[model samples]
Target: MNATTDLLPEWAQRPVSDEFLQALTARFGSQCSTALAVREQHGRDEGSIAAPPPAAVVFAQSTLDVQDAVKLCEQFNVPVIAYGAGSSLEGHLLAVEGGITIDVSRMNQILSVNTEDLTVTVQPGITRKALNDAIKDTGFFFPIDPGADASVGGMTATRASGTNAVRYGTMRENVLALEVVTASGEIIRTGNRAKKSAAGYDLTRLLIGSEGTLGIFTEITLRLYPLPEAVSAAICSFPSIEAAVHTVIQTIQMGIPIARVELVDVNSVRMVNAYSKLTLREEPMLLMEFHGSPTGVKEQAEMMQEIAGEFGGNAFEWAERPEDRTRLFTARHNAYFAAVASVPGCRCITTDACVPISRLADALLQCVTEADASGIPYFLVGHVGDGNFHFGYLIDPANDTQRQQAEALNQQLVQRAIALGGTCTGEHGIGIHKQGFLLEEAGDGAVQMMRAIKQALDPKNILNPGKIFQLQ
Candidate 1:
């Protein structure tokens, strides 16, 4: 078993010896599973990538359990993939080379809350919404939403951000420390609860967005923000997509302290209206939020309204009550699902690209024009305040031409993002579908450096093999 280089088979074709199986069974007992349902669930995520199920699933309940699973898989020279809430839009959960998936869902526990320091320690399995819920009693909250109630581990793994990111920043800024288990079964804790540090080597930042290729998170220590004293949300409609985007551009340029500013095209608004039973104006619109003192929130909203009106923002509505605020955000978060339902029996080949703030309108309009001209159905949404947007090209999965058309549009948008001095992906990481564009964006030299790091960390190539550039 120790002679992996000479004895291992080709990829997933490597046979799992009876002795290895017996060892796992004896050590973990009922925590180990070979159930078809569990394996299939861990094999894929919300993305459109097709992959084979993992050979087995282990429900990891603690950092030690994760260590045991990785140590055991290393003996058989098998891959170890981490699983969170299974809500990732990318194929981060897919076991492309068939290995053992460590389901961290059972490790959902909040370990500590340092209210004085505005930090909390939690297991990797806790979801964003759950974390906020758990800390609501303390008056401090975590701000990296990322739309879905994604696992904190998954969010940190992907370096996720959401609407609030326009003002509060992303996970990259909010995360302070992490506890990781390396491929060699060694635990590494990076950072502390302090607000600032002059530490050697920012390993926490390195592992945050590694996407489980470098190591898996066992516990996370995150920065927290106090709940705003006053909050306000508004919906504004524009005559055209360009007008709406221009408003966002102008608002950001003015340095408005908006907590969240989202853009929705007429098509997306129409779908949401039908699916959620809200008669929002069928025009390009912006959903905005502001947080501060009562007087400050009022001042911000008034300033935004004045700017919105300058750019043909009509039919503006405000949601100040808690119920109203919930309704507005719930509909916004459900937009992706509602869009898929709008086109019956269709799956989306989603596009996520971010351009320079000045080039936002150009990047968005070009893709919208092309998609409309191609006669394909799509729903457009964006965190426009940050120059990031998405287009869900809904197509029947069984239709060859539609799939090709969707992919073509996705490539065009990604290329546009890169050419405009921006990124190929703003939030959604480079999963299997976006791997082709990674090298195009990062270039050969940078990708090679990444590969070198991957090789140095996982020499066995047994940690989530075939992800983030297919190193070695």
Candidate 2:
């Protein structure tokens, strides 16, 4: 047996027998699968880097099933990787250590919607779109939209955020509580539905972005918001990239309550237009949204326009109708894939760096210049209003030279972000891809504290090992 496997308790090391497999089949007939191909498919996430398959796959349909599966894994000294929608960009779901994948999609269900308290409880496997659709008629909405229709459980696991994050806040702010299955098959509830409480430790916040390291989230209670009285979206073009970024900076500085403020470079604009079948001017653009009473939205729009004018921005192209706004934002949301589609058969390497507002322009300019000088085709898009931007590079991984160049550029970008007192990843958690960078960002002492917590919660190291940090 391998050193790691030898260390596992006897139960973990024993191979599944026909009887055991039959038992699993009897319990979860359609959900249990011992097929190598199926297990391999559920092992990795959406990242382009390393991928390791799990030993088995179990499609969990309820919290009880999750608890039982975890118990079985614990008895065998095997790892348990929690699987959601498998849309993670950072390889958070990759089964680095072979074991079992607890597929949570079957558990998808909206448990309850407490309209009176503006909170909803849901099974972890439920997708964000499903939840929104379920509550559409209630005049309430869950605003932590991450663009991909990712699962609520996965969003909570990664503390995900996207366009509306700048306004409605990320999962960290939306998740009020969680029902988690711990490493040892212990079920625990963290937090409550109350808006705020001074109660003990904030365990809910701790587990919000644990990425399945601390526990497997079985259910989540999230705060909700009433649908806005009015909503409007606009595309404002700028002659230069700097001008577009400056408009965002100034608008935010002026305290304009923008519902959404996103910056897309000219190159990305062309790609998006092509992918979405829209003929928009191929210029640097700021896609924005305003929400409030009709008059308030109009006033905000006017204020934004005035600020844009000072920066040489064009008149707003409004999308007032529901279908129009959906089409526009959907196109915007697909910018990453659109850029990837520009180069057929090429893989995408996306890197995110967040800097202080004062340094965002300089940082973005540095990235653009570096990418240009490296001769690597890339796309620049960002939540500029929040000083976080993503650089998507299309590379032929088969070409070693190109791969090295991309890595060099990524390292430089991350180092610069650290120098500027910013995080290596703004929203994406520190999965395996960013472990080294995370250590550098957190320093030895802080990293040590993180290790202490990990050990305290999972001494056996059977839950998503080889992630976040390398244990001593």
Candidate 3:
């Protein structure tokens, strides 16, 4: 009854054969599953996209397992979708072409740690938080925390960046290398342990944000940082969103190495206050963090407070103790969930846009004003210091008009960002939701090149079909 196969590439636009399916079950034994309950679980994730469940779910424990699954799917030309922690926001794991979902969650492992070199290799299923916890005793931490307990492979696939990105950069800069399995099930290493390389064709960067469309990442080598001796967090309230954004722009422009500078508008703050039980002013606020020696942190905090005072920002409230800092950021990290829970029976649609630091205020204000005018219950959260922000629009899925309106608003905002010389997606890669934006952002020629590469690597068009780009 499912006609999704009609959209797949001509090479793979056919239903999986019964013989190959039987062979697959016989080969993998307990690792392969076809129960309706498990298939439904692998059908969707944190995203709002609707996708039919895959034909089967393969719980792969190793690269060879992934290769075996891929090879089996290849024989029957069934598309393959890789699954990790299922924390993707852009529907990266959706099995649009009716294929097999390869669940890699059981492959969690921290392979090796090179403390002196400040790098660590981890299996794709290892979450960022788990990796950090594993290396906590090593006096170093993996700083790319994308809020969710997202697997390193999922994060790498999405090229995720988080609150720490303002100071530490995103996965794009942190990932040193990757071990990937091509569509044909051949395993290949993209980079080495060396910090820098003059290697031909930067393949690691290509696969970093491919969102499992190109190849599945088996292992990821990531850069790590020395844990700060003295870490401190501060919250500053502002008269308006503009003022708070201006302060972030000014702070970054002044070359201050603020570890994390997050902006939460009054709406989000109100929800967070109720959710986190924090008694703070219901005004636009910035949650900031600094990492350094004790004296350095003190100096940084003082300097930031001084700048905040210049832009109608209230006196900074500092959280110095480890316990206090944890509680503060935990609330900040829970903002998205807090927002969704604020209203009953409401699902959230998020929009991501990033502009030049100087243009952030304008872009953010435009989006805020439009969302405010739309009469939609929305909350604003951003990494303002880096000019990337997200609008969480709470909607009733039962109402089709609200969903349509939100989609239109997102399109307008993305166009505005492009007009202002910014990317359509700052962190969340272009899964099915942003494919149109990808065409507009990367232009025809670049998209063609991407298609060419996809065809060359996965000529059968079996790797996560209907993602990033729709092959003709």
Candidate 4:
């Protein structure tokens, strides 16, 4: 067993019975697949977590289809895991306990576009990029991009945030409403198209970052932003990571309203340069974006340049054209893949640590020192404007020592972030990988409350069981 699954109980790994399989087949003929290929596709995600694939895969194309399939799982007392674009970075998609995975990629569609209200309701399977493309001509766009073409369901499930989160917000802030399937196969809608409501409990907020443990998202309503009138992207190189990070801290403290600000360490800069075939300076760099009216964007850029200059940042480069901005941001998004390719046949154990803006330098630099001293090859990148960063430690799957070393480094990072008044995971939800840390960060009392809520909502323990926390 892998590190992620070793601690799970054997009872949770219940085998899928022929009775259940036959019932599932009878419910949906061709959509129900027991093929190894289909099971494998729905079994894993982008993380290093490993587990046996589910016994069967259900392709749910509509809300009724999801409701019916879930009802069958409920009847059989079997665990049900939701599947989307499969871009999750933590172990959110792994089937630690043997179960059936409901793939929602086929359900991708835009249900409604209300330009007047600046809101869009969509099926759970639509990706952020696809959503933007569908509404590009409407003069509005969704800004909660998590660096991947992650499905809206997965993003909402994890409460994901990305480079633009500094200005707009994460899924927690932008998600307005949801249509969810409860463990009992009941469809429930929470919140509405209207912005703010003080009517009793905020179930919408409760389910946003629950990581599919409480319910499965069938439809989501998101707040949209009008396209920025004027936008500009820039990159500035710094002598060291400290300089680059400090610039971000200052920019945020001064209220610059920078749209997106990302930090790429020297290792990542070199890797992305090689992978993207660009001749960028191999130094710690800050990639930034500004949005507003023409004058406001210009003013923000000028203020940022002055702050960067104070920290000895140099070689300010601008990418003003739309194509140029895409090229720069695309390279930033591919940094993870570039790091993986740096070492042949290597997988990554990534760390997501977010601290208060004032403590970011200490949290980041200390972690960097430990990583460098441990001799682990890794790439460093962050949406530093929001004080969240990731270190992708490349590890050979066959080397036990390397894997342990990476885990130790990750543990150290998490402990440090918690000590500094931060979270173990900034955006990546508590999947199988970080359950232990979730207890450490939130304490037993709070975690028990969460467990209580989970138990109340999913009495059968069939909704993505064995995630977030292990039921006692």
Q: Highest lDDT, which number? A: 4
Local accuracy of candidate 4 as per-residue lDDT tens digits, 119-176? 9999999999999999999999999978989999999999999999999999999999
The candidate maximizing TM-score is: 4
TM-score of each predicted structure versus truth:
0.96, 0.94, 0.96, 0.98
**Predicted candidate 3 versus true structure: per-residue lDDT over 1-472, tens digit per residue:** 1111222332233486788779889989999999999998998987676667888999999999998988888878889999998878877787778889999999999999999999999999988888888999999999987788899999999989989999999999999999999998888999888989997999999899998988898999999899999899999999999999988998899988899999999999999989999887899999999999989988888888998999999957888788998888888888988998898888888888889998998788888889988988999998877888999889897777787778877888889999999988889888877888888998999999999999999998999988888887
Report, for every candidate in turn, its global Cα lDDT versus the true structure. 0.87, 0.84, 0.87, 0.92
Global Cα lDDT for candidate 1: 0.87
Cα-based lDDT at residue 276, candidate 2: 91
TM-score of 1: 0.96
In angstroms, the error of model 1 at 396 is 1.3
What tens-digit string does per-residue lDDT give for candidate 1 at 402-452?
878788888889888999988878888876667768888999899999999
For residue 433, give model 3's deviation from the true position in Å.
0.5
TM-score of candidate 2 to 2 decimals: 0.94
Error of 3 at 388 (Å): 0.8
Off by over 4 Å in 2: 1-27
List runs of model 4 lying over 4 Å from the truth.
Answer: 1-5, 8-11
Point out the higher-scoring one by TM-score: 3 or 4. 4
The TM-score of candidate 3 is 0.96
